[model samples]
Target: MSAELRLASGGAPAPETVHPLSVRGLTVAYGDAPAVFSVDADFPAGTMTAIVGPNGAGKSSFLKGALGVVKPLSGEVRAFGGPLSRARRRIAYVPQRASVDWEFPARAIDVAAMGLYARLGPFRLAGRGDLDIARAALSRVGMERLAERQIGELSGGQQQRVFIARALAQGADLYLLDEPFAGVDAATEKALVEVLKGLAAEGRMVVCVHHDLSTLQAYFDRVLMINLRKIAEGTVAETATPENLRLTYGGAAQAA
Candidate 1:
């Protein structure tokens, strides 16, 4: 587990190059009990990876730790081969839709504009240029038409898209999303998948906490299979096998 596995379909990526995200001996806990065990993993640049696991499997906790929002009991997280603090500006995180209170009195465009605040810092407010960028990001996610609508009025998928637009407005080099496809329809999933692929094509790293196993190969370049700890990590072709899926999902995977 010391050496990171190469996920290239052609072959392993060049060893001389550095990974965009590196986790070492990471352990995250919500109390005395550890939710995420020591997970050492690396994500290379320019790839879309899915972090798939069952419910309550600590997938979201891993994301929170990686984003520095959840404090780790032990270990370290590095981005762009350096400390996360140095790379904070280059990272964007999209939280799960269920965690947000849609009735919080905000327009769709207003939610998206929050992304630009990274550049503005805590004390500053978004101005016209920021609003323009926010609208552009909303347009990218196909949510521009609903910019004036309240977030509470949008559909589940539309709300998800608005959150993504918010992340898009950040203009970060790496993106992490949690359960983005949870309640979305087929059309929304397709659109979101294409947008994620486009991000990778632009040499940005995209990691998602996904639940779907069937579409793993079709949508992502790499897949990280976990069950409270790292079980498998590599190209979808390699790590998404039935045996590994079984190990990650146990009897549930078999039942499915």
Candidate 2:
């Protein structure tokens, strides 16, 4: 992956239309104040990017804005050179584990199969072939044995894997995950990292709202540091420097 983003005319890189994701001045607000402010970035295919920052620094807000899960107050988001609406089927998003309703009566396989609903349409149900695909996805995440288990009955890591299996079933070109490793066991974290790295190797874009700064370099090819605004972005070695961390975390830099 390229460590430095190439700049176009006027010293600003024009959005690379071919890139899997490109944002221009994207801003999102909750109420009177903006949570994510004027952020411009591009997430290229074949790379795993971590959006890292201090708590309340708009890391999750940035992902929500880019995906339109939460409406942005300003700017634009393009997926594979087109509007997000036109490219929804090619993208898969897994929200934070905490945000999910695990108590909902759904089996692991049932959750995985939901990824294929885009192709099933409103009138069609999951056929045998669809179930097979979902099963294969579960196996990929080492969750096949728990296919019949209820989502709420699984451990934190197991639940995360099931969600990843769902994303894999989508066969999406872009995968966006929000804090997939939070509260998971070390073994589960290792397995999840391997699965995500495999996707990047297969030429897919993998972006995560990541919190663990210590593992940023080990887990991601690129890092986008934010603190309610764009701080720095590039290869982990180049972007996650002491000065940048200090700038991003301020007095709480040590904790970060």
Residue 137 alpha-carbon offset, candidate 1, angstroms? 0.5
Give lDDT tens digits, candidate 1, residues 75-101. Answer: 889888789999887898888899999
RMSD of each: 4.6, 4.3
lDDT of 2 by residue, 150-202 (tens): 99999999999999999999999999999999999999999999999999999
For candidate 2, what's the RMSD? 4.3
Q: Which pairs of residues collide in model 2?
A: none
Per-candidate total of colliding backbone pairs:
0, 0
**lDDT of each prediction vs. the true structure?**
0.89, 0.94
What's model 2's TM-score? 0.93
Top candidate when judged by TM-score against the true structure = 2
**Looking at model 1, which ten-residue stretch has the lowest summed lDDT?**
1-10
